[model samples]
Target: MASSHPNVVTLHRVFDSPTDPYVYIVLEYCPDGDLFSMVIDSERYLMPPEPYVQDRSRTDGCPVPESPEYVEERVKLDNLIKTVYDQILSAIEYCHSLGLYHRDIKPENILCSADGQRVYLADFGLATGERYSTDFGCGSSFYMSPECQDGAGRRLTQYSTAANDVWSLGIILITLVCARNPWKEAVLTDDTFREYAKNPDFLLDILPISRALNDVLKRVFCIDEEKRCTVSELRASIRGVPRLTASNYETWERLLQRGLLKASRPKEHAQVPVEKNTFSNPDTNSSPSPSPVHSPPNASWDYGPKQGKFGQGLGPFAPTSSDDSWRILEKGRPR
Candidate 1:
């Protein structure tokens, strides 16, 4: 546990008993809950209550001024995003310095403080020390990098773990501002991601993110892991961003007119289509499909096709069960 880093969850101790088969880990308590809940709450602050409907009858035709309360809430959310994002980046940088890579980076893995002003990066179950790893399809599908997915069945010997972490961070940022995932998975089989692969700017047509943030995501999501933006570059780009979502009513209206931003709120969860049964690998044992774990109200979890032992994949919001090797525990009372 990288407890020295303020943004990383502190690990107090670990207990292993000869009689018991499970190993228990004790971690710092964060009562405010995860970032997914914060994002859901911020959705209202991103836009005004009423849609920006144009009226030609009125002589003084301008968007109504936002209430002072609305302005205050928006400002608070903006500052929170900046603070949490900066802290998360610092935590990742610290981990990378120690020759570690967190394969799972998502809102659910981020814990918040009592005042909602602090965040801690947790769940390093999938983390690895190796810079390059052959563990394909190892993370949440929604936050996975295109190269990591290996949808083409290239049978890649390994992929850069650092690059994969950056890609997942990009997705987390998008969800924070837009309250929706950019795509179901970073693979050609998914229509949204495929469109993005072809046109880097396609996200602008579907999501309500600012151009600056979109530019950052474009670099972060480079198909070539070797060319993807590093954690340092990502921090710089984010600091330069003026706003996460559309800055003004005019910008929001323009996107709406272009059939980009929907009048109603976006769906809480992404609907993934199930694929038909495929031939199982003779070399590996087959198992039943795992039941979709219960997730938070607005949290998104990976339910894509499971890869075989040595197969190439074609395709976290909740505290879902992991493999038998590890488990995390909190010291304080539950939130």
Candidate 2:
């Protein structure tokens, strides 16, 4: 289901050996590695990598080279951060539309393309569907939400996975913009997050990010799940960035849907011999060629049409129609 979203790592195919208990899941290979490396690089340079930079020529539909100009680099870097954030939120919103939620959303699980134009949300092993519910904590401590943390050995209370994901997104945004984590962990008991939760202006004092972005972060890190912005709301909040347009999102969505349709089609069957112990090896490689597998009903995994909000046509968040609508929403937000 997630493979259909361009911001998600594609799952080429999954094959199981009848002779062994192991299953082989083929996935897309990203040349640029994961977002953790990108975060480190951003910190080193205090900006986005050259490949990901967006200069003014970006508005004229041209890619700019890595410039020696510092002011130009900083402007490009800010646009790049907003662009990445838009995709991240879109990926999460798409997952929610599928009734799925990613429990782990830290930088380590996010992958950037070699050219750095694309970022994918990877590592769904910790993700869960809406049907799941639990009081136990999960995911990395650094990005966990206040509710996900047990207060100094106290039992964790039941919490919404969707809301927990929003908290992680908040942490990720801070890491991307500030090039450093605001807190070691997000827990009400932790002095860092607790102070921020009480007064989010603390973020602005440390980092010189815009008030618009800070407002978004404050709602994302809100201690009360009821107050935290939903993925839909997050999309609306970030969509108002002047340089980050909606067309990029619509283009990726259309391309991903086409790819998903191709991948979802049932494949032709073929057999290849494999040794018994080979399945036990973690690094074992399979044939590069595609093979046939049973494709589930499109209704079960399809997320585009049913999950849209406005109407049957991409819902309320549809890129074409909702761009201006979202702009109006931004006007109503607190400064």
- Please report, in order, the local distance difference test score of every candidate based on alpha carbons: 0.64, 0.58
Candidate 1 off by > 4 Å:
17-22, 41-50, 53-73, 151-155, 248-335
Instruction: Report the C-alpha lDDT of model 1 over 1-335, residue by residue, as the tens digit.
Output: 48878899999999999999999999899987887665554332234332233232332222344457866776676667777788999999899989999998987799888556788999887899999988888877667787787643355778899999999998878766655566657878777677777888877665556677788888998887778999999988898887666444544455445654323322235331222223222244444342222111111112122211111221211111121111123212132
**Candidate 1, run of 10 with poorest lDDT:** 316-325
Highest TM-score: which candidate? 1
C-alpha lDDT of residue 186 in model 1: 81
- Candidate 2 — what's its lDDT? 0.58
- Each prediction's RMSD over C-alphas, in Å, is 13.0, 23.2
Give the TM-score of each candidate: 0.69, 0.61
Q: Give the TM-score of candidate 2.
A: 0.61
